[model samples]
Target: MINYICNKWKAIKRAKNILKNKNKIPPYLKKNSFEEELNYKLWSTKGARFSASHRNHTLNKLSSKSIGYLSAYLIIIGIVNLYDINLLGIKILNNQVGFISTAFSVLILLFSQLESSENFSLKSERYHNCSLDIAELYTRARFIKNFTINPITKQSELLQISIDYDAILKKYENHLPIDYLQFQLTKPEYFGLNFIKIKWIWLKYYIKVYAIYHILIFGPLLTLFYIAYLK
Candidate 1:
């Protein structure tokens, strides 16, 4: 796995090097109006932000789902053993539970392996970093547009902005473009709530999905223990 990761990183570096050597501002940008250049920078920054946000969302969701499933499976096994109860009154022997747990373990293992192979988390982080870099360039361009009036100075600054933008693009040229659906999902409305509110919502969501599963799995064991203590 280490070797595979190393190779992938090396390949990405090689591609970036090649792109840097060949990078150039688009022809249209060579003589574009200030307004046109600003618009382009704004659009490019938005695209990068949208892509980064979508990838981050996907990575988070996948992680939550995988962990939830594995946690539920383990909790169920522990509860059944601790209580010595036939869950749902369905007779299940120790060996049968072992088999079931092993099957689930295998499934989780395969999922983890697949996720690692695809490197979705790594790619998402990289895209997010690229977006931040592009945003910085966009801010600089906006500042230049607002403050600079001399045509020659404006042109020189704009050219430099284009070069910087191209450099960032070349470094992340392999990043997949955000699809229409992803773009829609990443709209501000989806995360427009204040930070505290958003975190509360996420907390409730995880509790409903994962915490409930835990309670269901462990409730019987606790109940059994309580009854024995009462006796």
Candidate 2:
């Protein structure tokens, strides 16, 4: 049992090499042999990589959709503002108010969507980590069971399995392994800082301009109406 556990630990250590190799192979695992250990390592590494990449791609697609909707909103606002509605005066006040209201709604929607998407991405990373922990546990258990009962080898195998399983379990318990999935999920500084910074600058500008528009168009109009007795 102990010898088998040691073998599994060695197998996992060796599997990390597969990531760099273009032609990664499962360490051809055979009892008490190097080949068998390598095959196990290879499969585990590949599975992790595939899972991470797939999740990241899905997140990218979702973010792109949000960006698309935001772009359309800006375009519509641009078109509406181009019309010479102001020259018509008080009659256009109601429509101008409606446009401002719509812009506020879109701003709120954008903030909510970004928050939700980021939360979902973080959850996916957590799920990936849990899956990895389970896989390591299963691998260690398999090694302990295989080497314990098999009559194929010497007492060394039992000792090796014990050491390997202990090492693997300790490694997992300590959370010593760095999860690339988590790293990938962390939002890029460029996206959060640069992209969002630009978006928000424009949004702030829009809000400022709209505030001015209200003061310019409505404040004086109401004053004039009151003077003329239309309050």
Candidate 3:
């Protein structure tokens, strides 16, 4: 009973338009955005039960509370770092534990920033909604179908023609927005900064500590050697 005005050809054209620009769709269709609904359908539609795919599809949201916690931690650590770096100076602060702690803390903060760049649940929600939206649009577009064709070789059928949603599911199964976020999180090397690339973000903290430890153990010896050399 539901025939669409915008049938297969029109839908395909719309998709092409979106793919071409990756921005806002044309003005006429802008009011009811297809992307949001399409994402919903994508998430709701079930797919393979493989561990990797299953894991990838799971919805996860980052709480604002978690952001607050990280922010507070960074602030506290930064204050300590500034206190040592400014008041004590790195050389004098070597005698204290502040220098090492500051370095470790800053590295951790930067790494945390990289991790929080993308929100998982938010992106997944968009992808899931967009899929369903497109399907609904297609269904509606059928209602407006005004073309006619022969039964045997129908070039233009009723708007109720079925879409291969299952095919869409299969194609985008693993490339969901959440999957992109997961990829971003796991691929730290793709990001910048020397420590993260070298896998030393965590170890750098200990390196700082070791340097401080050496400074403490050898400070006196170095001072003596300096005086002896001067003599």
Instruction: Give me the candidate number with maximum TM-score.
Output: 1
- Using alpha carbons, what is the TM-score of model 1? 0.54
Best by lDDT: 1
The 10 consecutive residues of candidate 1 with the worst lDDT sum are 177-186
**Candidate 2 colliding pairs, count:** 24
What TM-score, over all chains together, does every model reach?
0.54, 0.31, 0.28
CA lDDT of each prediction against the hidden true structure:
0.64, 0.48, 0.43
- Tens-place lDDT digits, model 1, residues 54-103: 55557556565665657686668767876787654555578877886787
Candidate 2 wrong stretches, greater than 4 Å? 1-64, 80-118, 150-231
TM-score of decoy 2: 0.31
Tell me how candidate 3 scores on lDDT.
0.43
Off by over 4 Å in 3: 1-67, 77-105, 116-122, 134-231
Each prediction's RMSD over C-alphas, in Å, is: 16.9, 18.6, 18.0
| lDDT of model 3 at position 32 | 67
